[model samples]
Target: MTQLKAGDPAPNFSAKDEQGNTISLGDYKGKKLVVFFYPKASTPGCTVEACNLNDNFERFQSLGYEILGVSADSAKRQSNFKTKYGFQYPLLADEDKAVIEAFGVWGPKKFMGKEYDGIHRTTFVIDEKGVIENVITKVKTKDHTAQILAD
Candidate 1:
């Protein structure tokens, strides 16, 4: 798949949320979206990043942006993570990795000298028209909300 860049139209997809509700990119038409892809749900870095976003969720909403986090974890795992972190936004389960691959966030990763295929930590700022406004490839989990807000 081609690497997605700013101005590229985001791939529309319908995925299952933690609560088993269906969520589609088209459902947010005419609204800005922050679509974030993380390696795993409830991991240290992922948890911090999720909580940071949760803390600033109202701010994003105030700016007319809806936040959605995706991972290859199962729905149960996503639900547990959301409940544990008090996440106000939806967390989509992408066990099939279709959305992840479509966004070009699923690929080989290296950590501690071991390489494996997985979801890369990335985020996309999609505009109301479904065009990608910005691609945040280097995400710092601890302060992700402030970083995105600053951008």
Candidate 2:
């Protein structure tokens, strides 16, 4: 897997949103994008991150940034999570792990003293010109939005 870094062009992809709409990187070509990859839907840490993003949705919008959350969860699960949390942004279903692999966020993880392969909680901030502006690899779930916005 090629690890992406700041100043690199973000790997482009098209994924289905919660509402089953096709959203592609090209669609947001001229806009700043916050594309976050998390392990699962509705989990404790994931929930905190998602909710924090939702709560600060407007602020991101005001800054002309679009938010997108991607996971290996099924479309149904993503839809349910978005509805339950009242999220204003799109939560994409990457069950095939294509986009995850493309972004190099799928890999081994350690949780509770056990090692396993899973999605890394990472966020990529793509600038308006489609270049990666910043990468938040060690994401703090609770203060995720603030951390990204501060970038």
| Best prediction by lDDT | 2
For candidate 2, lDDT tens digit of each residue in 21-55? 99899999889999999999999999999999999
Over all chains combined, what TM-score does candidate 2 have? 0.96
* Stretches of candidate 1 exceeding 4 Å from the true structure: none
lDDT of 1: 0.91
Candidate 1: clashing residue pairs, number: 0
Q: Give candidate 2's root-mean-square deviation (CA, Å).
A: 1.2
In the range 9-108, model 1's lDDT, one tens digit per residue, is: 9998899999999999999999999999999998899999999899999999999999999999999999999998899999999999888888988877
Clashes of each: 0, 0
TM-score of 1: 0.96
TM-scores of the candidates in the order shown: 0.96, 0.96
Q: Give lDDT per model, in order.
A: 0.91, 0.92
Error of 2 at 130 (Å): 0.7
